[model samples]
Target: MVETVVILGAGWAGLPLAHKLLKYTLPEAKDGLKVVLVSPNSHFYWNVAAVRGVIPDAIPDEQLFLPIEPAFAQYSSENFEFVLGKAEHLDPEKNTIELVKNDGTQRSLSYDQLVIATGSHIRSNLPFKPIGTHEETLAALHSLQKQIDVARSIVVAGGGPTGVETAGELAAAYGGEKDITLIVAGDHVLQASHILPSVSQVVEKDLQKLGVKLIRNTQVKEAQTDNAKRENDVAVAQTRTLILSNGSTLTTDLYLPLFGVQVNTGFVPPSLLDSAGNLALDKTMRVTGTKNIWGIGDVGNLEAKQLTVTDAQIIHLSSALPTVLTGDGGQVVKEYKPSSRKMIFISMGKKYATGQIGEWRLWGWITAYVKGRLLFVDTAEGYVGGKHLRHASM
Candidate 1:
């Protein structure tokens, strides 16, 4: 019988791993390996484009959905399969996985090996969900587009990378007539990155030139939308036409909270994680205490930020998996090596971005063109064997 390798969550990490395993997996082994990718989404989302899509004239919706079938064709083998379902839980001991389909049906699958790559969820307490789910995100974008069309005030909460990039793209799209303000509870934006000092300085300058107001060290206590908004800061409450955090009141037609991201691991067993609720992994990215189980990407917490870090990790693990499949103990007798990792890449707009890589601060349009412009939407589609879609207005 052929051995099955099941990968959960076909997002950033799972898709690439399935592709590599199916393409490069050796067929010589009598156990002929089968690779299965499980996820509810038939298409992989190039999430980076969500922010840029806020602009009415930006990328179109048809271009975003990269159907998974074409990408699977690149492997050139029937050993690969796509399971359309949500992973309900994982059982490493039994080497089985539970899944729930869209129609409320449930099933169990046995696996010889497993990979967990379910990504994280957006974090916001504003009674609104993150702008990732297709329906919710599109609704938010449409609302913002309408606001922009009417020349309304735009207020973006949070000053992290997502917030900064979102504000920049929105400002660039609407031009100066769009009243934009970024409210950061922290002292400066991009503070989590090593490039914060210099990059924040330059980005701040650019934002100022673009007529964006920066409110620093201010926490927004309450946000209510009605005929008017009433905002309350620490020890201060005021009713005005528009109000935000930091004991200040300002009117804005649109309010977007880009505060933080929440990880959805409820489908996974708590025992699989460490004290911090992160998967415990060996140097080779295998689940420390579970045999034939591997964890990659954000769920793995592999000492790298989620995003592209998951890509490199998947490559690193997938390249070495063949050895394990053929080996006696199912472990790579030789060591595994990780590919080069890019530290951080920030997209300012259509054709502009800045990033840091191993003590080097790089600035250019290459990153934006390669990633920021379409967020690899067409590329992902092409990889998945879907017809290439046209680029949306940058």
Candidate 2:
């Protein structure tokens, strides 16, 4: 009897891991193992380029979101399978996972091993979240752009990279046509403490030069989570209101919140989650207290959820899985070593960016090229075929 390897989520870690699983492994170790990918979405969005996506008509929809079917067509007939839906429930004790189909039916698949990499979500009006299809996303993005075009006053809450980038982009794109204000809860943008002091200062200087008003030590008192409602209000509201924790009221044409990232582990039980709803994983990327289930990417409680770090995790798992899963005893298992240094590529716009490589902060067109230019949309296109499972364009 062949064992099954079910992987949940088709993000950075899951897709690459699927490719590796198909490339290596000789089909069987006494009984063999098959791989199945479960996801509710049909397109693998180049979500990193969302800043550019929010910009009206900046890039084409095909560049931003690539259908996964083209990528998976590269693979020949094999033991791999893709379920068109999301995991509704996971039962480790029974070794079975249930997936809810698009038509609202539930399908259960049993597996000998499982990997979870559902990723996280961010709350922002910059068209950052993943939608159903490429065209739908593009249409919504155009709406956001229209709102940006006519807005007289813009109040952007949160000092994270998205907020900073949006503020800068709006100023640069509009050329001081709109009054752009950035409000951060921390001492400086990017949480200040998270990046080098000099790097943070440089970012602020860039925003100031772009005519963006920086308001530090402030948070949004009125929490809004509905993206559709946000869009509707942006089109309808002649003047949007933002109530701040500092007791200051902002009247603006647009209120964009670049705030918290919500982890996508709601399908999972709390027993497998941390305090923040993130999947709890051991040092080896194995889910806590589970011998066969692994967690990776933003969904896991890893120090860094960057794509590079997730790739490293996949690399380690590639070498470790065969020995651990094939019933081979006494195999040396390598523990995942997460990078101690912090690395980030934050775009001020397509022209400028700020980055951190270890102790050094890289700031120039190089940063812009690395992450800002094309927003890596072209790079993401190279990885379309890894996830071949698509029932719908969405």
Q: Give the top-scoring candidate (lDDT).
A: 2
Q: Candidate 2, which segments miss by more than 4 Å at Cα?
A: 26-30, 123-126, 131-142, 192-194, 223-238, 327-332, 386-394
lDDT of 2 by residue, 163-216 (tens): 788788778777767898999988888764457877787888888888999888
**Residue ranges of candidate 1 with Cα displaced over 4 Å:** 26-28, 73-78, 125-151, 227-245, 328-330, 333-342, 364-378, 383-394
lDDT of 1 by residue, 1-394 (tens): 7878888887766776776676557454567888888877766666667667656768776665566766776554558777777888888778899989756799899998888877666566321223333444455555555555554678888887778888888887777777888989888887874554776776787677667899998866777754432223121112224455556777666677788766656677777787766787777788877778888777765575446455457657766577678674565434445545446777767655666676666675666666667666666554444232222100
Q: In model 1, which residue pairs have backbone atoms overlapping below 3 Å?
A: 70-384, 70-385, 71-383, 71-384, 71-385, 220-245, 242-250
> Could you tell me which 10 consecutive residues in candidate 2 have the lowest summed lDDT?
385-394
- Candidate closest to the true structure, highest TM-score: 2
Cα-lDDT of candidate 2 = 0.73
lDDT of the candidates, in the order given: 0.68, 0.73
The deviation in Å at residue 149 for candidate 2 is 3.4
